[model samples]
Target chain A: MRSVFRVVENHRESDWTHTIFFDREIESTPGQFMMVWLPRLGEKPFTLSYLNAVTVKKAGAFTEKLAALEPGDEIGLRGPLGQGYPPLKRPALIGGGVGIAELRLLALASEEPSFVLGGRTADEILFYEEFRELGPVHVATEDGALGHKGLVTELLPVEADSYAVCGPERMMAACLPKLPAERTYFAVERYMKCAVGLCGQCTCSGWRVCTDGPIFPASTVAQMDDFGKRRRSKSGRWEAV
Target chain B: MIPLPRIDPPLINASGILSYPEVFTAFESAGACLGGYVTKSVGPREKPGNENPVVVYPPEGAVLNSLALPTQSAEDWERDLEEIKLKNAKLIVSVYGGDAGEFAGVTRRMSRFGDAIEVNLGCPNKEPGEQTIMESIGQNPALSAEVIERVRDETDKPVIAKLSPNSDYLAVAESCMNAGADALGCGNTLGPGLAVDIRSRAAILAGTTGGISGPALKPINLRMTYEAYARFRCPIVAYGGIETWEDAVEYILAGAGVLGIGTAFMRKSTHEAAALTRDIWEGIQEYLDGEPMSALIGAAHRAAEGGDSHA
Candidate 1:
């Protein structure tokens, strides 16, 4: 698998910086990611922020190199790997943070969508303009600093065709009540060392995040022992283990 | 990256590391790059394999697996062989069974594939399953010959009997060759071992006992490959803990045509296969090929003759 896009533009979209427009030809569904390798620096995995391609966020040094590249830049990329969200027959796009990327992509499948979004503050929220045509959108924010006080999870869709989410595990968990067991999916951002199944470093206990999955039905997360609870820290120790 | 012979692309992604190459036309790159695929060991019938949590990786990088073989079905390979699209590789099909009839049954079905068939003479986990070929043939030369003889008659393609390292390696290699196999694959994993989890005060694996492989088996695999080369007429496919291009070169020097990488692929995925194959080919082109294949015949010859540097 090779990366086909270059970081054409880079900008901060709040706390998390956004590599606004990379390559339009990336062709990933949503939630799918590309493994980027930087010469001498090593390789890391990032989720595709754009629905049809890769719109990476420039939150760190790795993204900085990608962000600094012009349209003619060449980089190593492999895969639109892992399962992405399937289109909802009806329509409900629910998400937070970069998790909104998946919901926005799902909106491409729907004639119109019910966008239920949230963020940390008013400025942190994104994709409102492009997704507004998808139908109605509801927003929530922590600290009452944005659209609604409390949490983005509070703006769960009351009724809709189906719901898709991406964000902190806690936010996805909060949306469980608003979604049917069969109609919702959450893209798990896991700590995976090797995406191609060899290293065995991404074992979520017995399940392999690389092989078993990165995307599963909402019910699947419920069945997992510690879905969103496990978080690793900088020292190679899991923070919330 | 170490300069080593890259064999083939990684194909099998089964629970352990054994590949069922005959299943798909192409293999995915997980690790190990042999020029061809060696199907996961199979039996004549369906294997329920060991109970759940059949494998356990202890702190020291040791694994204890009691995999009852839990393969789909032996005959399924026949159905899948047609779909396989192998290229420039000598597909070596590995089959495991309780007795000669069952072993031959898999080969007979695979005869049409025209791919070479390997008879798994000894798997450490066989007895408790109510059947075993190891005890019958592996422990005895006459019985081993009978089993190989039976499997040989079933397939028109080359038959390579995979011998166990636990037994007398040279004698076993000889017995299979005498029984009419075209080549020999030595050996299967080392030991019928056990692992204990101190916290639970219980055995780690479901069956409690399994085979040991990886770097631990390299020296022994080298010795056995040498012994098989010295004693047998049929060629030998050196297997066990071969992870580097240098390791593959050593096996080739000690008389292994194709080195079967099991544990390396299990740990690294099959991505190393093509890399290793290319490396070895170039090493040979740079050094080994035009000379007689027999020039690489023994450990003593390699050590004394300087076909390889003493690493």
Candidate 2:
């Protein structure tokens, strides 16, 4: 519980998502997450879309409450925790839906990153303009409301020196075989309790997701037996991913 | 004193932390200096435990937890043990039950998998009815002793009764020793403490209450360990808010045979946890100046009695 209380310096909302900018800069790399706390509402891990901000999708009760918060609201943040994406030259970044939140910082830091973003509809494809401003952007939607009408994995750049994929595990798993395992990095998500190494709740194939990684090389990700199959529920039971 | 498992550095990840077999491998691979790893306390049956917000930090800088021992079943652990391997660490299995019979059943099933059986008699965060049962078992000397006897009947391995700091610890220690417990785990977290979020008008944790641990708990746990050691002279595994080598030495000096670290791990990764362990071990070695660590156990008592309490 090493949390630093900070005021929500600014907040912007768009299409069921809230991007909150805290009062100050956080010393963290792209893949690391902060355990955002809202007093009695509890804490949940969120990857920073920027060094000083977190983009949260209205997914559950916690996020729902967080969505209702304003700029002056006080919140607590613990860590730019867990391992982040390794620095790569011209890495192709692939994200699906809200999963793009984790790769935004990497895109900001990389020299020339190729972006492949997918969503159910064009509206679901977030940060389209933001990512295009950074580098070349590829877009896909299930309903053909955007760029290409298909999955994000179909548009992954095989020519990039490396790859970083985030979002649904199903998409990442499908994208796995296409990229060289040694060169591809994947940001994983799981039900995290402590957001630290203490609780084994976020364990994926014995690796503590909170500490060992929220981001791992595809080589390591390939070795995980439960990768796209199952995940531990809040009650410690295994449920389908 | 009856023989205890060989824990070279005599430090371990406290129960309720590092439960998964794979996580154990992760820590071992990272060179965690702990002599062993304690599995999360398992019961006769699997329990999912409380909902989210299981652990929290109060404004006091201490941790409050109501994990409620979310555990896999003994059967599951047996399956895990069959496949698990650790090159440099020993395994100490912790077990809990609603009563002596339930406790014994799991111990009987898990006995062969571990070097020792840590009877969790001090967990404070349980479902409504179960909480009272656990409290009574930890606080009442007779009931506590009965649980130990039942567990001892099931396993030949050393039985370490983890006592509750909120209770009459010395009485509980004596009762447990008389009942044939080989060792004592000093205590569990302090209060089923409450930390309210004024803004939300409710408790911060989903469980409403959680046991307290951290720097704030050290003195209470140290005193309990010292008192228990002075009275029973039993091998004691001391844990309470230990974060550094100085804290480690303090417990050793106070008669702790081993140390259980929990809250500190919340802030460190495996590599850092390993470093902390090595740091604590090295600090103890420097303080010992070549003397065996055992020589320092209860040394504080000896010093207070004006005996030769040489470092």
Candidate 3:
């Protein structure tokens, strides 16, 4: 069922994060999303920040409609709709900028998940303490503002087990060569519409970005069309085949 | 003398027939004269259905499926319903479940969109637990009544029970009406209908036996629709083998208030039902220009009073 629901409530700019509550309860694997379109507003896909409390940055068109929404505002949503990250017992998580939302829940869901979160400057980091309370957290900002003076990838621990990572593709590229075979890396792709998998809109390489995966293993997406060391445009739109 | 009735919104379709409404809106000329969006059946829980290789193509005209109702959980179906654009379109839900409780729950949740909640009392290739659920409730009227009654407790929506022709059709249909069902969706596919490769002797579908649909089942569907109409007054939605408006209208004359079109949605990028819908709307408009829709209701009564040839 490609469940579409109305926005029951939306919180604009809550600590610089927009929290939206939908009447549709989305039970999903951590990395899944719904292809949300607001008619004339254009369509964009978002990661599951917190199914219980969905949050988005007031960044673009999709978020703007979401930001302008009042209680009972109607929004076209199709999902809880894609494959989410596989459950991990113990894992290390890595993310940067707004991409951290993709890895946050996984950090919260794991038995004990360690995380490395980074942003442009220390002040721009999204959820620092949020990750710290969930597990041990390491931080790195590009300007040497907070914990480390380099990119967040510089702070990623050399882990030999399970890991769920979301950040700039450059960061993912730097870490891919360092990853062990047993380790799992769940990455997010943005251009998903018809999250039900019927829409070839989000097809990446041989698989569908929407239904088959929004979160795929580094090994699986290694040679695949879109995923590697480079970030799928944060705008994450699909390219014409 | 037997009595007969006329059907309206004369076609039924699979639950999730096309991905979005664009396909239906795109080709509005394919005999989709009906006024309702007959949704692919949905449940209260998210069902992943069977894995891929779930659908297969055997021949140019022949096809097989084992799409074990690949769906989001049932709760999610309701979310989809919220944004649905029915605008003057009747909404019908074709639902299936492994047990009476599951069926009841799925139906009850969707009863908010009245019109009808087609209770699938007979889905042939369900897994063990679900197969047992359908057989147990469908074969026995008392059990069937209990299942229908359970759904009635939730909403006053018209309950359209989809009966499997393989079981005792007339009996199950009567039980559904007795339990407050307003209509019947006659004859889902037959007997874990089997198909195998002659050379390999192996089953054609991943699920071994699958529901036989398309042209292969038309004659049987027509026969069953006639039989159920002959015995019961509950409205009927005839499903199977309906490729043309003429085929659909034939079911209407026989006595299906609505009809379900499956299999064919896979055939055309354009829905044949769109053509059927135009024909139906035009016929109604032309008739209303000369007489009132109320006059059509009167005609139905006259047709019923005239000895029935429909059955």
Candidate 4:
């Protein structure tokens, strides 16, 4: 159920990212997401970055309103829903752009997981210091302003027994060739309405991302024909992503 | 007291929403207080529905969807139904087909899995040819009766005809009841409305036109229920844009024996549906304190006929 929560803390994480902590505690796993309701603006899903916090990147209309939220502002929150990535040994966590927010809780939960963080430029990189505290950190920026100067997938370690990746589908697809499909898990993003699985808006090749997974095994991802090919818009029309 | 296959609370999840088995179990566990759950429309074959954006929420409390009735085959749905564990909720499997034979075949196979079967004769997103099938079968009493009779021939399970509000639903309701349908799922989504994106200069939905639902659809569907109730004796399972306690009470007052909620659940979290259901029940209790449940059911019809002394 949705409960209105007052923002306890609103800290700017970076130039484009902000972290909002709720006064109420929420039980959530690393890869699970919560639907944030901004009264008149509409609802959008965001990955849980901390126990009671969601990190937002000012990317669109909903996120902009979320970013502008101040301490004491009220917003409705529903879930920590969906199947989260299972625990793994010898894990490697990779994230791209704001996708790093999705990996934050996972990294903290892992036993010394290797991290590969990527963004368009150095300014876009998020949670670098926090992630660095949890594991060995590798940074990649397309503009060559940070660690490896290409895609974050380029920096993913080749030897991790199990891997957790969350990012743009293209970025995850790029890493598929190098990783063992059985040992890798990827978190997918989709246009969703009822995060509990009613609205089939997030279905990818018959898989309802909201219920079947927002996080899926790489083997499952490999079988999804629409994985990186297309995504549905808010109006329910498919568009090449 | 809906006439066929008794269900308490008298509310069920509508078709096209909450198709997943886990979702059904979750809603029940979360205390949505539903009498039953209707699976998304299942057909003879696995249908990979229309291209995306399949759903849109207009500024009003309404939603437009062009999902094109995506469903796994009846065999697949039957198998999936086996895995679901509904605590106390009844299962009403909704089946759709391209033709009467297909509908009967699917209903025959799926009937064993649910307490009742809901025949979907009104999906607005069907292609022109398929639309003709739904329109012909739903609007033409003779054709609708034939289809219902064919389905009735397949199973002893209660058969509910889910009709289209876009046509003469009152006639369709009468035909369904006459043809052996035990009940009627009062309506499906209302329109093949277009939602255009001015910036893109294109229709927002992949199918171009989609079924209109949500709060905006309540009045249209309620009227359909009132009319159907006034003309027919079969139980009316009313659905369309019910989001509040008042909306639920309105449906009951309009002669609906059961309530079907879909878009309303979409507007809130699953757990919230339980709260809403409680509020609706409480509202009904408050109203019932003043009148009998029988008096509330078909009150509008009775008042219109100048037979309701309360009116």
Which candidate number would show the highest TM-score if scored against the true structure? Answer: 2
Cα lDDT tens digits for candidate 2, A8-68: 6545446788777777888898898888877756788899987888888898898888777
Which ranges of candidate 1 are over 4 A from the true structure? Answer: A1-241, B1-18, B22-33, B59-62, B127-132, B267-294, B297-311
User: Model 3 segments beyond 4 Å from truth?
Assistant: A1-241, B1-10, B19-33, B56-62, B128-133, B198-201, B270-311
Each prediction's TM-score versus the true structure = 0.55, 0.90, 0.51, 0.65
Higher-DockQ candidate of 1 and 2:
2
Per-residue CA lDDT of model 4 for A75-180, tens digit only, reads 8777777878898876888888888888878877878788878899987778777777777788889999989888887775556769988888899888887788
Model 3, span A45-149: residue lDDT tens: 777677754667777555766766777665555456556778786788878777787786777778888887888777656667787787777888888888888
TM-score of candidate 1 on Cα atoms, chains taken together: 0.55
Best candidate, lDDT: 2
What is the C-alpha interface RMSD of model 4? 8.7
lDDT of 3 by residue, B230-295 (tens): 677456677877765556656665666566666654422233335544664565455447654433
Worst 10 residues of 2 chain B by lDDT: B127-136
User: How many angstroms is the interface RMSD of candidate 1?
Assistant: 15.1
Docking class of 4: incorrect
Error of 3 at A108 (Å): 50
Positional deviation of residue B220's Cα in model 3 after best superposition, in angstroms: 1.5
Instruction: List lDDT for all candidates, in order.
Output: 0.60, 0.84, 0.60, 0.78
- Which fraction of the native contacts appears in each prediction? 0.03, 0.62, 0.01, 0.08
Error of model 4, residue B3, in angstroms: 4.1
The model with the greater lDDT, 1 or 2, is: 2
